[model samples]
Target: MEALKQSNPGIVVVWKHKALVDDVYYSNMEVFERVFWTFGPCVEGFKHCMSVICIDGTHLYGKFKGTLLVATGVDANFQVFPLAFALVEGENISSWSWFLGCIRVHVTQRDGLCVISDRHAGIIAVMNDPNVGFTEPRAYHRFYVRHLASNLKTHVRRNDMRDMFKVAAYQRQERKLVADMSLIGQACTKAIQYIVQVPLPMWSLFHDVGRRYGICTTNFSETFNNVLKGARFLPIMSLVEFTFHRVNKYFTDRRELSQTRSEQGLAYSPKVTSIMEKNIAKARYHKVEAYNRRLHIYQVETKRGDRIGRKGGHRHTVNFQLRTCTCNKPRIFHLPCSHVLAVCVKYSISERPWVDRVLQSEAYANTYAPQFSQDRTILGATD
Candidate 1:
């Protein structure tokens, strides 16, 4: 633990052990219970990433069997950005509570943060506990849509249940979501009932109000777990070392990549730029009518597009001042939607300035700006 702190400044590593009883064990003897750690670079990088966090647990196949808990965030490039990690005996209320507490204290203190995880009883209980401070107004807890779909499929005994749930989960527009839910109800009443039991805002994109940033699952954490597949088999110290090296490389590689992209004069990450390009192409099929010139609000009407198969005649309101569109794409994804793009094109306004900072190249570079002590390779240090 001392070595870790010495190598990485501002690193937070915690070790918890069972208290020894005077009658049972010696004063110096203690049993290890849990350990949590977050890299200094990762802690600093997460501030530039999305506010949403995805957490998951994986089993350890080593001699001292345990579970590995991972917390990851999504970068502007839509890649998994590892934030914190823990090795606990198992997934339980006590361990999960302690893990979450450590994350709040050491990793981030941002309010209105959104946390996504499986429907684990331990996580649900801890987040619901008022003392834990994971509830609304401080943080919002949501279940991964994939896990919810799996549970619904298991309970309903229907093969199509998962597909139906996914359609509803990915819907950005409220009317589209209603149509998808109606279809699910017609397909299986039990499935819709099972899904409705879970809060709409918890899983559905339409009700998420851009809190999820278009992420509907815990795949980010799961992907990081897969990267540490071999490390989980090692002992505690070995596992920690393995994770440290891998995460250092992850940050170094991404930082360099962002630097190269910035050198090419890219305003946004490739993922964000690609999405914007598609929206720009679609914008050609939309006609914009100015509604409030002072407020920069316009009503955008869509025309039939053969390439996108978009049905024409849908009207959407775009407010440039608020950076919102009635289609909800801009608010949900933090980028301009077709309607907003059309307004920008019609008025000869630049769309780059309207994109959220989280998706911009500058923010992406800032996310990976911190250098690990091991390499000391600096790439666009925003600090």
Candidate 2:
């Protein structure tokens, strides 16, 4: 622990032990139960990433088996950004509470942060507790749609259960969500009861208020788990060393890439730029009609095109002041949709303000700017 702190200043390392009882000998050493650690660079870099966090736990293998809990964020380029890691005896209320508590203290205290995870009883309890920082005002707890769909499958016998649930879960409009839910109900009446048991906001994007950033699953954390699959079988100390090197590489590689992109005069990161380009192309055919100049409100009507035969053109209302479009894409994804871009084109206004700051190239560079310690702390390893 001292060595870790010495090599990586600002790194957070917390460990817990089993409580001692009166029956135990006084001289007996405390039994180590779990340890949680987050690199200094990761903690700092997360500020430039999205506010949404995805957390999941996987079983570790080999000698001294345990469960590895991971928390990850998504960068501007939509890449996985590992935040914190923990090695616990198993998944339980105490372990999850301790892990989440450590994250709140050492990681981020940003309000309105969204955390995505499975329907684990331990996680539910930890997030529901008012004393924990995962609750409302401090943070929001959201259920991963994949997990909810998985749970729904236990009750509904339909083969297309996941697809139906996804249509409901990913809907940006409440009316569309209700329509999708009704379709599910028509197919499997039993599913409606189980689905309604969980709050709409908990599993559906329509009520997420843009906190989810369109991410409906814990796939980022799961990807990180796959990246560290080989290290999980090693001893605890070896695993820690492996994790340091892996995360260091993650930072270094992305840092160089972002610097290169910034030098090339890119405004937004790769994913954001791609989305903007697509929206701009689509906006070419949108006809905008100004409503209120002071309020920056306009009605954008999509011109009939080749695909209009099946999917008719849509007329959307865009409000620059509120940064919203009736299509719900801008508010939900924090980027200007085709209709919103159409308004910008008509008024000759710059669309930069419409984009989320975190999705910008500057933020992408900041996310990977922090450098990890160069010193290799592996046992009996030379520089």
Candidate 3:
């Protein structure tokens, strides 16, 4: 620990120790109760990523049994960017609150942030506490739909019920969500009752503020937890060292990939390009019925089988001036959906302007531009 501090002076490493009484230490020798760490490079790089973050805790299996709490951010390209890590004695209200408080102060001090996590009682309580909870203007807390589905299984127990619940959660329009939930109510009234007990804005995408940025689950943080699965068995310092090297390699590789794509003169990241291509293909099936050039409003009509609604075909309202579509995909993703694409094609307007700047290659490169410095502790000090 001393060596690490000396090598990386910018890294924030916090340790909580028990109070000594009568100028004497305890005999048990468990001096440290909790530890939190956030590398300097990660702190700097997170500014380029989205304001949304996901947090989850995993059990450590080493000689010292404890919980590993991890918080991760999402980059413009939808890649997972690890932020901070903490080791606590257990997963409880106090532990989670302490960890969250540290993150709020050190990492995400900005307002209008969104946090995603499972519905753990501890996490929920901490996030809802008026004094400590991230609420209203500061931040919004969202529940992971996948975890909710798992809990719903105990009541519904049917694969179709799970599928319907997912459909309702992912719907960006309240009408569509109501329709799907009605279907669930028809099939299993109990499932609908259970889901409605919780606020729709907490889990449903339709009512969420624009901060979610298309992420509906805590799977990204879980994926990072899985990446460090084997490292949990090592000692605390060893685990930290392993994570440092692993994250360095991750940033290095992604930086190279982004540079290669930029050299190709790509406007957006590969994932965004692929999604745009698919949307363009779907756009061909829809035709623009009316275009008010002065108003920048368009009315598009879909063919019989290309519509998303229950009806055979439907008309959508697209206002390029406001960068929105009645279907709600454009407003949610900050990208032009198929309907908007069709309108843009009819007007001969380049879709590039409609694309969100965050999805572009430049943002992706900026996210990984910070370099992790080598620790002199690992390599002997230079003359």
Candidate 4:
């Protein structure tokens, strides 16, 4: 640990020790309780990523059994960007609160941040605690819908009921969410009651004021954990070394990939481009009807056979000036929905301008621009 500090002066490494007395310390082995670390480059690079963070905890299989809590962020291209990690004795309110306090101090110190996590009691308590919590004006907490749905199995085990619960959680508009939840309530009042206990904004995308950037799960952190499966059995310091090299390589590879995509003249990342293409294709089935140039509004009428929303034809209002569609897809996902694309086609407007800046290749490149130092290298850095 001393060597790591000497090598990377900018890295944030925190250690908590069990106290012996006011001025005295416990023995070296007996003192250590928890440790948190964040690479310097990661701390700097996270500024370019979205404000949404996904946090999850995994157990360490090392000789000293401890819990590995990780906080991960999403880049502009929707790729996982690991931010900070901590080694704790267990998953409990005290441990989680300590870890979050470190994150709040060294990492995300800004307002309007959104944190996504599974419905872990420890995490819930830490976020809700008034004295040491992510208060309203500062940060918002969101739950992983997949984890929340798992609780519904106790009340209703049917697949259709589960699907109804998902529909309510995943809806991007409040009216549609109400309609779906009403349907679920009619099917199983117990399931609806269970869901109502959780705040709508925490799990439902429609009501979230913070820009979650379409990230609704802690799967990003879970995926990173899977990548570190083989390293979990190493010694405490060895495990930290393993993560350092793995993350270094991740940034290096992604930086090269972003450069290649830019050279190819790609305006947006591959994921964003694919979504736009799919929406463009769907736009063919809809026809643009009335246009109010003064109001910058257009009415997109769905074909009689179209089946996206309800069965028959439907009319959606599109306001180009506001970059919103009545269907709510564009505003929700920050991409041009089929309805909005139809309006773009009618006006001969380019779709590139409508794409959110965060989805562009420039933002994707910026996310990986920070270089990890190769000179101060860790031994056995490979998986």
Candidate 5:
């Protein structure tokens, strides 16, 4: 392999699918069981006091021909908790059910806030089905992937659903889902509603992307995918090493990020502060009951010509602010209105603070920092 690599610099050694890295690497049933079973308690223990759980799944291209992996985590301070991982056929209900069941068992606190994830039928199935949960309110959850759908692609039969995506996202849309999923689509919609209802010990449990005071979706499993990126292509021993190394790096980097954030004095940089203030001001856009009534009256007058309520088509009419657009986003659901984005523009108010910290790098860890005393406490650093 070394000789071949030396000769062909571009060569990527492709191993057969489902190849185990160790005797226990998915091959040893006991090891597989251990890895799989560890998910619930591990996550349960990790998310003990947290309010929201951000969930997502990605394909871990490996020896298992075209197999995928699904996982979830809590995103406090952008910290990642390894909830679970399973080699699965595809990202669907069955896979999510198994994963959620593990989490449900581990999530003994019958009262944590909802889990957030991208809107795939699999996740929606878990969230929407009344039978999926053991008790009341059915463990509320939400889906933020509505932005993934585009207008030409038409994610929602009702205009309300399509309108829920980021405005820019909806305008520059692509049709990924071909067949129209009417019932299943609604199930996903209801699932999101459930997410908002889950009781949170505090508002901090949920993230308000765009700072819009609503549950916005971020790909929670994105980092896990990064951890697995090149590791998936390596051989067994290499894969194991890669996992440990990256996970180690993940923790190391996270610690550094925390310390750096602390030193930066909570005041943000001028540019970021400007953006944040703008977003906050945008969020400040509030009106009383009269404002809503006036808006509703205007909408009735303008959209009177269109048979919006009758539902001649799969699309439903959605209302937002002064706009009575036909989409499920703001009108049907009080979530962000992608249509508003189309008419107005990206409101700066709803953006979250954590995302901006990465680029400034000021509050982010200097990856190769020198280690000093215990806890890697910088030689001159305090706290």
Candidate 6:
């Protein structure tokens, strides 16, 4: 946004997860089968920052046992952008769908792209999800190629209508599957009643790529998890919240760094400065048709002595609030030429105050901060 700040103006949030959590919630609660209030907006921030989203899960053996999965994305500069996290019962369609849905709701914008792990069921979950009912002619869902390969692996060894095998497959693939299935079974009929009835999409989001890459074999998420390896784990909520705040902080820092470099380039990097100069001179001031800054208005010069505009002279005018002398420079180059500067200097308009406020960097850094306790190690985690 700093690069094209005027072109696209909007705010974005980013989020991520800490260490893995398994069985964080009870299977009776629904997709997560766990206990906790849903904090989704934080997750959506991550997706908005990174066009690509990565998802994965691990079994938990702590106080509450369940599979903890997380979703993260990459920002414009290809840096990590936090998304959302979920506690589920192993990695499965329901768990994944729930995670995806959380993200869909959390991020505010409706037009950005998405990238997910190469997992078969994730593809299936989005296709088969009932909540994402066929209510519209244009339903948008996307996934990466790696997930299809994962789907193939699990499907390859499966047969039809064998409930036990289904449970066994879940168990075999994920050890905690036994605990999850048992937990769901305890819910009697309400839990399993509508599962199969859910409509799965006919085409996988990345179905075409699976043919070439093989089914069930992409570790983008798994590999990324390593980035958090050995890192101190925090509460699930804290982790998710941290993701969004952190992404914003990173971008704010990056923008500042870019600005520093740009200024340095303006003074020393002729090649870089030339490009910016050309854009300022040619793209902006080639012709004057209307007031570019003013949303509505007509531009005209008063007759001085008074001719409004003379053939051999420049067109001087006080159009809108900007004083554009017969010379055109301020609007075109985002910098005042000698003529306008002369007016400002004569009028004693403090350029220093306006410049600092217009290009302040402190707000960029103060975007958000981790809620640090006087005691850094003492964190209350939301499972």
TM-score of every prediction relative to native: 0.92, 0.93, 0.90, 0.89, 0.44, 0.38
**lDDT of each candidate versus the true structure:** 0.84, 0.83, 0.80, 0.79, 0.39, 0.37
lDDT of 5 at 87: 42
User: What is the per-residue lDDT of model 2 for residues 1-383, given as tens digits with 9 covering 90 to 100?
Assistant: 11223334645566666545456744456666677778889999999999988989989877769999899999999889999988998898888988888888878888889989998999999998877788897788898898788878766866588679988899988789989989988988788888989988888888988898999876788789878979878877677778888899889999999988888989999888898988898888888898999989899988756545635367889888888888898888999898988888778999998889999999999999998866544322211
Which parts of model 2 are misplaced by more than 4 Å?
Answer: 1-8, 19-26, 308-310, 376-383
- Ordered by TM-score, highest first, the candidates read 2, 1, 3, 4, 5, 6
Model 3 lDDT tens row, 60-112: 89587899999999876787889999889899998899888878766768777
Weakest 10 consecutive residues of candidate 6 by summed lDDT: 1-10
Task: Name the regions of candidate 4 deviating beyond 4 angstroms.
Answer: 1-10, 20-30, 130-133, 155-159, 304-312, 375-383
| Cand. 6 Cα-lDDT | 0.37
Q: Rank the candidates by lDDT, best first.
A: 1, 2, 3, 4, 5, 6
Tens-digit lDDT string for candidate 5 (31-68): 22111222122333343323445676554455633233
- Name the lDDT of candidate 1: 0.84
| lDDT by residue (tens digit), candidate 1, 201-305 | 889988988888888876788788877879878988778778878998898889998888888899999898889898888889898899999999999999986
- Model 4, 105-180: lDDT tens per residue? 7777877788899888998999988676587768888888877777687567766776778778888877888899
lDDT of 5 at 23: 52
Question: For residue 340, what is the lDDT in candidate 5?
Answer: 36
Q: Per-residue error at 288 for model 6, in Å? A: 34
